[model samples]
Target: MIKSPTAHEISYGLVELNPDGTIQRANDEAKRVLISEDGDSNYLFHRITNNEIKTKLHECFMGRANEFIVTIDNQPVFFLFHRSNNEQSQDRIHVYLFNIYNLLTLHDHNNWNNHLLSSIGEMAAGIAHEVRNPLTAVKGFLQLMEQTYKEEYSHIAQSELDRAIHILNDLMSVSKPEFVQEEKAAFNVCSKIESILLLFQNQLYDINVIKSFQDETAMVVGRRDQIKKALFNLIKNAIEAMSDGGTLMIEQYEDGHDVHINISDSGVGIPKDKLRLLGTPFFTLKQDGKGMGLAQVFNAIQSNHGKIRVTSEEGIGTTFYLSFPKKSQYSTQFIGGNTMLQVVDSKTDLTDFLFKNLDFYTREWVQYLEKNKSYITSLLKENGEMEQYDRAGNPIMKLVAQNILEIKTELIMDVAKERGVKSAKTEFPMHLAWELFQSSRGIIWNAIKSFYQESQNTLSTEEFFTLERNVNDIIDLYIDSYTAYYVNYKEDLLKSHRETVDELSVPIIPIAERVCILPIVGNVDTYRAKKIREKTLVRVKELKANQLIIDISGVPFVDTAVVNHLFKIVKGIKLLGCSTILTGISAEIADTMIELGIEIDNELKTRSDLQQALQDIQQFRIGKD
Candidate 1:
């Protein structure tokens, strides 16, 4: 009697062979993928040329090993061999074959990525020096001009030149760190990691975060900001990997000698062959990435006396295991706090606990603020503002709760600024606003204490402080943004009172038919520079000018930023079919431009003074006529 074929035989190219390597039976897939056109069963066994693979297959028949890979006709194939357990029939080998062509293609791509990254690192320093040399020489000339002239414009020019040089220095530092350096300090690894995680709160709505932070005082000696930036990139990558939403597991623990942080994600895992190319510069799996993120991460880890190991299986997930040599230090207590930010990674539990008691804390906060019955407070009370304040606490607490739950603070601060501006518009007393913000901190801390007691005091010292700092830091930021906006709005009102209506306008005077003169007389700041660009184009088009003469003779100074603004204005004017003739090139201004390495635009006509510019324009008109 004949038996039915298994699923493996139907799906894959399956073939059954006797112990002596003779063909028993072949599936349709097996004939198409493994067997030759002659339809001989011996061809399958004879195709595997590797002696090691042959030995492994022989062992599979003897009931020892069951999996082996072999190359047949320059193509890699996977074979799964199993011995049949049938009492009535003879012992046979059941082999499942699969083609792994795509995987090898990916391997080839990663190898190319690795080679390209090596070339970039070697060329970085050369590029930096080649760009910086001209700027350095120009800066030297500008210094001499500043000494000879003792002008304010040269000082402005020098400042802008320094900024350009600084950027080049930073580029060189990232590419070749020994060329530039930073100081390393001992910082709380757990708290830093927690803070970085908070930056990704909005993206975590669909993600389930599981944090297992055992050692809160896991100190790592490194450049604090650089390490933070590196961790931010790694976490950002982890979040991007899970587009469909999955588990994000962040664990931090310590052995006797070292502290370890394991960041794992249940996303599309990286293939084994491509893992080595992960930190290579300009290499990325994501569609919209510059690829410097992981490169910086790798550089930071190594520079900070840390090691990173990664393990991943395609379609399963990936984990980054980072170990740093532990820096042993006694915990110091922060003033007004339990212990100095020895924080744990119990983000989910702590956030949920605070949210559960959010209402109680909100009421306590409003009641405390209401005790201040001053004139502003009394006026607000009559306007039903107390209820509004009470109502506002819920959403604010939700934002703060999101912060504790590990979310970004940008939206929270934006809301804070809006509220601050509204308070200013209502003429609310700044001190009373301060008191309102100050009182909430105490109420939230009280709620945290209740959570601790209710949970039977099981919270670790580090875990308690982590929650404390997270709450305090967020409230402090809210207070800063709130107060800043309030004061800025009031100042803007005062500045408006002092200025005349005409002073707010950009001065554009029409000189001739299809020609205009914009004589700029005072210092041009970013705000005024933008206004200048807007009005100049409008006036030029209104007058139907073919030439716009911008005379900056009376203007005090032009920095690098002002130069950029002026260049943009010129470019815009050209796009509108009008020409710009710039006059008043002072010696100080000339030196500044040289130091900034600014090139004169070919379309722009420059002259020593307005008189010379008008002469050239008249001559050009005569020539055209």
Candidate 2:
């Protein structure tokens, strides 16, 4: 039979750069990897990004470092380079690229889904199996409502609730991985094998029953009855295979914390094709076979935390090995509730277990978000748009995933700090920080809640408490750390805002050709007076202004010292061939100026208001003609 292909080819791109760091050659995939639109390879990276990628690529040549993941076109990709010495140029770089988007998409589409539409169609066909009872109940309720109200329109409310039932039916079609709660307890494998031996003792009269007990270390963490039934099936098959007479060998031993039971039989062995399908449902090689024996045997072992492997050659013999973790209830060091966590952690594949189930965690979080979708959306939307918070593929989710892969708390804090600065600079406010923190907490809690829901009922009292406390502590730690980073960044942002506002107060407005106005607003204290003098001179020189208007209409307070500083500013402007045009002189300011020996006319020109000064400058041909 021809089998459909269920695998995908991983995509890769390569580029060879000259010793001097210029692109020499690139393949079609390389152009795609670089997000090049024109398909040109020459000076590509330079044209695309700053020298950041070039620098990082060059660093790959240093020492033995050859590969690392880098973000190219806003997605992570494996950046690898081979440093080979070039005869014509410097060190030649052979670049290789493989991005995360393609890898993850393949895992999602090709590996995860095979004929999804077909499966959905099949599920739709069986939809009646699930919705039958619900529909019956709803129909009965709707009839009751109609009778009670004595009107057909009265049951419209009950009828409308059919959408929820439809949704429930839809959920059943999507297969979530079956997570069976494992109840761990010490059970003797040798005892189970012995029981099977006793059960088959009378039946295996023609066969020679040879049993080997190797040190009797047969304790494993599983239900004993399941093991007994599975072992009995294996032993019975062995006995049945040998109709005339044959040796049925049974051996049990423990290797470290793993218990192994090996069963062998010299009988009419199974064929290669049938051997592979031995445990498949309704599959059998025997003439008088129900086909549920091996399937039940496989399920019994699998359900009780055990793995079974079968090896056989036709007309020779068949051997089976059942392996399971040796019980460690009394052996392990007992702590508080953490005992359960320790057991799970020990049994856990620390490498892939967490990652393999990350989708489950994310899905749970998304479901939670949807549950409160209305409230969250209302809180986030501002001016008809969500305030930095997106319902799909949001930054918080992306960051959480990255953190799941690597402990990027410090990196995250740094980014938060930078965000604070940008937020402060952009006036994005501190509430956004809190928003991300709160939403992330919601996701984390949802994940923990789901995990607890799945296993809490099956865990020991000690393990359950330990798991809850650990989850709480982790959440508290995140809250404390994230708050610290956000607060620090927010403070920095506030400080930057203050400095910016202060700088903006001293306004420099360019009016006409070679003329600028320095509108000094509010009270001119000693500090403001000093800044005014310095900034005025800098503006005049920078703008090449021949004239400057000192508007004091906005300043309510002017002391004798401030008057002297004005004269000094005029003198400084004279030195630069830029004349000072003073405006907004009141009667109070005129008396102070007279006391300082300053002439209002010509010596130090003054006007009642800014319009008068500009008109005077224009009349005298000093302003832009």
lDDT leader: 1
For model 1 the local lDDT of residue 249 reads 95
RMSD in angstroms, candidate 1? 18.8
Worst 10 residues of 1 by lDDT: 329-338
TM-score of 2: 0.30
* lDDT (10s digit) by residue, model 2, range 48-138: 4536665666456443345667776577877776666422234677888876566555655563343443343444543444456556666
Candidate 2 Cα RMSD (Å): 36.4
Residues 271-315 of candidate 1 have per-residue lDDT tens digits of 876786777555567775545677778878976778988899988
Q: Report the CA-based lDDT of candidate 1 relative to the real structure.
A: 0.70
What RMSD, rounded to one decimal, does every model reach? 18.8, 36.4
Model 2, CA-based lDDT: 0.62
Give the alpha-carbon lDDT of every model. Answer: 0.70, 0.62
Query: Which candidate gets the maximum TM-score versus the true structure?
Result: 1
